[model samples]
Target: VGGAWFAGDCAALSECYSAGSQYSAAPILPDPLVLPTVQHLRESWDDYQDAVEDDPEVGEDGFIFDFAPDELHKANISGATHEIEMVQYVADPVIHGVTGRSGITLVEYLRVSISWGGMPGWSFKPDQAPAALAALRVRPDF
Candidate 1:
């Protein structure tokens, strides 16, 4: 994974790294994945929200989470640099037929999640709620 240089309360870190091989000469893929399980996603979201709404020391994007090495190997493929934000919903997916288990499944699957703490502090003010709401307008026609 490439390094992430962060500023203020928001920071993006190198979750993992992978290198492509030429022909048959190749090296083991580095940091195969940045898989944050569903539980991890929930916890990270809760923590980031709490940091924004409660923790004074928590600067913008101050909360950082990464993938466990084994989880990365198991889930991450192609050595792609997956931002934690992009895979936070992996936690909502089921881990059946992979964990040596059966008949277990999870719901509410997604690919990415926005972090509350990543927002600039000024944007979270009471007076900005209306404008913020307006800016969130999503046009499905596109």
Candidate 2:
């Protein structure tokens, strides 16, 4: 859970300081997970086609996203940062679960999703995507 992608994306604003202790307990993992930055979401997506093509669980038409820290900005409003995951997928054997849905496997996408303008505190909907914020990368990762 500690990598360039995770740390960069997990960067938080002062508002979430109270929750700082939560991320400290991340268990050390053997796989070198990339902590991708906003700069890397697309790169990770681009790099993952082999995963999709190789895995039975993933479809060729996969959906990449503004995952992890990019999505964290939405969580910050509701103090729900705990809900997101801090990792990325690898190509071989196709890591089945890496998203924030309590380990449920969301079908991979070939591109970033248009915003859905979520309920209440979640509003990354295409129209509602927030203005650029240094702490998070809300940009679509196409």
Candidate 3:
């Protein structure tokens, strides 16, 4: 597995590095037999969306209920110099099936940036450039 550097403001962070960030990796399945299951999951998600849209209490505000506002706020805090974002298996989908089912997982690492807090407040010193550059060489496409 590999990691990347994601820079910019909260909007960019939300669009590229946040929880609902898009995954560009191709699908991985050990066998073609899992197609039905995959289809079912997709259909189930569509149905779930419909159900939410029809529900008065949950979908009345016109937005699908997902993460809590506070949680999202914490995840997208401005001026947060050090933070970690989990890159799920979907981002780099490769799975080995031992049985009929496979479990999804994720890789996480701390993303340290001086862009938000400015250089004076940055904990990452000049000496750490080589290490930081080595660690974050691959910037994924959004």
How do the residues 1-142 of candidate 3 rate in per-residue lDDT, one tens digit apiece? 2222232233411233353323233121111011113444456457666877777565444322121111122224331121112223236332222122233111211111222221111132334332333342343232
Which segments of candidate 3 are over 4 A away from where they belong? 1-48, 65-135, 138-142
User: What do the candidate models score in CA lDDT, each in turn?
Assistant: 0.31, 0.32, 0.28
Residue 109 accuracy (lDDT) in model 2: 20
True-structure Cα RMSD, model 2: 12.7
**lDDT value, residue 139 of candidate 2:** 45
Cα lDDT tens digits for candidate 2, 1-142:
3224222222222123235433233221111122335555557666666677778466534554434332333222222222122244543222233333334222222112212211112232223333432223334454
Cα error of candidate 3 at position 40, Å: 12
* Full candidate order by TM-score, most accurate first: 2, 1, 3
TM-score of 1: 0.25
Q: Least lDDT summed over 10 consecutive residues: which range in candidate 3?
A: 26-35
How far is 1's C-alpha from truth in model 1 (Å)? 25
Q: TM-score for all predictions? A: 0.25, 0.26, 0.20
- Segments of candidate 2 deviating more than 4 angstroms: 1-38, 68-142
